[model samples]
Target chain A: MVDRHLFGLGLRKPHYGAFLDGAEPVPVDFVEVISENFMVEGGRPLDVLRRVRARHPVALHGVSMSIGSADGIDVDYLRRLRALVDAVEPLFVSDHLSWSRIGGFNAHDLLPLPYTGDALAVVCANIDRAQEALGRTMLVENPSSYIHLPGEMPEWEFLDMICRRTGCALLLDVNNIIVSASNHGFDATAYLAGIPAARVRQIHLAGHSQGRALLIDTHDRPVPPSVWSLYAAALERFGPVATMIERDDDIPPLAELLDELALARDIASDRERRAA
Target chain B: MTLRALQHGFRDWLTSESGPLAGRYPAGLAVYLNTYRAQLMACLSDSYPMLVAWLGEAAFAAAAATHIDGSPPHGWTLDAYALDFPVTLDGLYPEDPEVAELARLECGLGLAFVGPDAAAVDPSRLGNVDWEAAALHLAPTFRLLPATTNAAAIWSALAAGERPPPAERLPQAASIAIWRQGFTPLFRTLEAEEGEALALIRAGHGFGALCAALVERLGEEHGPARAGAFLGRWLGDGLIVDVN
Candidate 1:
């Protein structure tokens, strides 16, 4: 098991050097890496992951599991991912709750799925296969959305049902919850309330791009205040779940991101006091 | 629709310019389409920077959009997503073979950067080889590419942030060789003689057979000498994995 509470940053290429070198005691407890990037057989990518893993606990966050595809999971992909897990020995593995590939063609984007019973079964089955193959319980993060189908169940209910059926944990991205609420016309707080707090094992906080009529989870900017508000609410319900700040584009210096991570630490620090 | 049908529908929309969502165009549909194009274009541009540098954004983007639609990523890693983009570039400018060559060189560099690791062949161990039966194993990251145009020169200049040299076809057939040396990607033009030998070596030829082919080109007196010289260069470049 991980610590009682931990704060981290999504490890990116731009910050690779600063992270490996002794650049004076960085503040993050653990680092999360995009698993597919380090699924290589051998190279600088795997080397760097090993060096960082020596210092901090690593969480393997994946983007291409396509866990909701009714066609079933890819065995080769699972093998490679399992190989990486053996090498890195990460604390736990995670991927988005959305599907990425279809018909053997990887769209390379996290596409939205309709919240239905059939979709739930597909996702839950895939999760069971993944967990069994990985030899551990996996966390599934909620994805930001662009569209949805009619006659579907609520998003929170879908997430909650996935956990109940598969015995998998959730990696709730507070910003995704906020972005989906804005795009699908649902209340964010109610979305939070619907989730079983005990099942949420981690939280993701990131920035978004506001288009003319929709919000995009771009993950390029600093954490905005609205997302922070949602995060505080998440802390209230799921106290001290492993928190991480993810920045993929326009990445600033490590110091700038450390400041944001500090803010997450402060907010999570208050959850216990507030509950008391 | 079934979950499978819904996913296929989503894919159809992602690859189509006519919008993927049904009914009234929600602003969110535009959001998805715009991000899809922008993100895929970025991946293609990163894969073939020199080609985009030479073709400029407007032209590259037009071809890239087509490539994205026709050749959706078959691999999980986006780094591997644009592997076949040079085919699109080749079709776009069939008259200019250099366009495809440039893309090949760029793609080769990316592959070499992430390919499997191997120990460089030891020069001290070179002399113990039985030439009659020894086969040289090339590094996994090593790539040998035939070139007719000055694509290597153009790729080099663009990679260095300099204006490309004048584009012209070479008088003789040339080749580009790339391999990673201690985690850094390195590429250079291979000599005509060495380039021919590389092709034979990659085709699983033994040392004695490689020398015989060199003898066919360089005569008996200098055949063994020339093959030895090329072997030395490959060893120094860390391109040889082992001798078996």
Candidate 2:
């Protein structure tokens, strides 16, 4: 488990210039960078990441590592990822709690896992392998699923089993919980309450879009009012964990995102004050 | 079931029609799987919008679905998944040179976006070098595309959501240079002689050798000076990484 807590925002491209100029530093504890964006040979992305890393503690949020795939982990991908982690030296590393490949082909989407015991074992082993290769404790974030697997344990139980077995950490995405809960007809609060608090090392709050039948975790809008409420509940339960706001599309100016991050910071600080 | 067997079953279920495994999932499982297919198709479409526009959305979706069925995702990153698309599409659209070229350009753009970051050599770094003997190191972000067809014009038009003009019956081939100068990736059409010069330089030819290639192509009278001018423009454009 991580000792220090964080309150940060996702480092996005639209905000790169402002972020580098220090024109709009979000009043948060740190920042999280999408790992693949900066994994380049040389360009503005790395330059900006270097500048931001100098000012704030940064954590890497990876999209590809397909940790739950049936095929053994991609060794070359792991090597490149390891090289990046070493270069960036993030607070902690994390990827989606899903599989993304089958038969050596990459679908690129974080496809939902079956959540069966067999799937759990495969995920745990993959997590163990990733952690060993990375030489650091990595967090796994729960994916927002539109459907549940038959005979699968509750998502919370699946997460609990994995963390207990692999010694990995959790990056609890509050928006994902609300979105998944709404889609699958589960109680969001109960899902949060069920998690072993000690395993949660970070929190991700993002905006979502409403689809015809399901709430898509789009990360393209403001944090919904209910997600904010859920975030407060998460803070109350998890204590001061690393929190970040992820906005991937239709990105507002940096100041607007910073304002949203400030809200998360205030909630965390307020909760800490009450506890004290 | 063993992990391997479950994986095989899941792959078969995903790629082929839903059969016995249909019993294992709830009524919503089909819905989820259908959504998954749509999502994958949407992602592929978004990544290769030009190709979709060229092939028409229906055809593009069919081809993308076929590709997905044969090659399931293995990497955690989506960027790498579209890498082999051009090669795959080439087989399907063998008669359509436009289809293959547009796919190649889209894949190239995706690659440029996720390619490794290297420290760009400041132009001032070349001040100490002798221009005649110096061999220029192209930035890792630079890519030279030699084409027998007008791929760049078609790509630009397709990207802008417009249909390209009909291909001209020209005997001469064209080449394009794709590189990320800052954050944005750029594509510029290169003259035949210029492309040859860059190819020589990329192959570790010295300035003299590059000049010789330019002379052989453009003729001795204009070759050396034209090549010199081209190098100057390339350096100014930040395409050259080092001169050693």
Candidate 3:
């Protein structure tokens, strides 16, 4: 089980110096470190990460493990990733539930999965393997997809099956659910309703940019109001999961992000308080 | 499709120029793949800005597209995607040593940024070692590049997002040292003699062997004194690590 933090924000390089200086620690209860950014040797990123870890709890979010790929997990990558986890001792570790590689080549993007029975088995096995390697429970985040595969079951059913089989927790990104559902013409509420409340461990709130007809999870802008409303709906259903705001590009000042995160914290708290 | 077949099909769609895979995917899937390619190219362009500016966006984009097609990212992290970019660019820009050298330096910086962190040994620990006989172990993030052009200057300027002046006639030979001292990555252009000494030391040559290489390269007339002075400066600069 993960700690119930009211809100967290994705750590970025722009805020590294301020974080080291202990300038603004009030806005977030925790921060999410992109695992690869600080994996490198003796540098500012690592130094800042150490400082941040000292001040607040961190969660390591990784992009590359390609857990759903048929070619098997990259052992070398895992070793490095494990070494990082040891160094940071994050609150929890997580990766996308999609594959980013095939036949030794990486697309560097979270490629969509076919969502078939075979993919389910492969993903569950990979999650089991990853948890065993890390010696800890892992959370699998739902990826924002612009494309759907032919064999994929409904996204929610897939997540349900994966968590049921592997005992891994889910990091449900509300924005992703909304975006993918809108793109695919599925009911976002139905998608949210399908996720087992007991299995959800974390929540991600990020802004998405619109492509010609679909929403792209660019993480460059502020969290859209519609997504925020959907998050409220998720809280009503899932009951105040650990939520974080992820802004990766055109990032605003730390205060601005915290303002956004504070809103989430308030929303989650209000819902929890109401339930009580 | 079987998992393997599905993977192969996806790989083909991502890499090859063919559009038939577009038909295979569900409606609107092709748009996603195209968007994926564009976003990836944007990232590659941002990461290798100097290289892109030097090669011009069109040519650089073509090269990046080719590189992506040839070696799609395997890790979720894009930080290490262009690790072999310099070698590939070297093949493409054989006559432009500046381009190749700049790519190497840029890649080195990127690697230092993302490579595994090692605790830097405090210089105070070196007081116990015999400086004259000790072989130096450069930090795990240390990288040395010998180049035939003024690429280091160009790279540094580009890193600062400054436009470099036109390459004034290429230099005979030069070298650059890149390493993470503390948490900040530092790069410096090294003289031929300094580069050779550091190279020998990195190759596990003892202090005596480094002097020998310096003497062999620069001759005895001024080699010993120059090498000794350079070693002192390197130690002060935090460039040399005590291996013993």
Best by lDDT: 1
Candidate 3 per-residue C-alpha lDDT over B100-146 given as tens digits, one digit per residue, 9 for 90 to 100: 78888877877776555665556666667775677776777788987
1 against 3, candidate with superior TM-score:
1
Per-residue C-alpha lDDT of model 1 across residues A1-276, encoded as one tens digit per residue: 344778889898888877899765466888999998888867788889889998889999999898988778889899999999988888779998888787877777777788898999899999999999999899998898977666378888888989999999989999998888898889999999999899888889999988877888999899999999999988888876789999999999989999998898888778777777
Give the TM-scores of the predictions, in the order they appear: 0.95, 0.81, 0.90
Local accuracy of candidate 2 as per-residue lDDT tens digits, A106-186: 555566777788888889989999999999999999998766656468989999999999999899999999999998899
Model 2 docking grade: acceptable
TM-score of 1: 0.95
Model 3 spans > 4 angstroms off:
A2-5, B17-20, B25-27, B53-59, B69-71, B74-76, B114-132, B156-165, B168-171, B213-223
lDDT of 3 at B229: 86
TM (chain A) per model: 0.97, 0.95, 0.95
Candidate 2 segments exceeding 4 Å error: A1-5, A22-24, A114-117, A150-153, A179-190, A207-216, A220-229, A249-276, B17-20, B23-75, B88-96, B113-136, B154-166, B182-186, B191-193, B207-239
Model 1 iRMS: 1.6
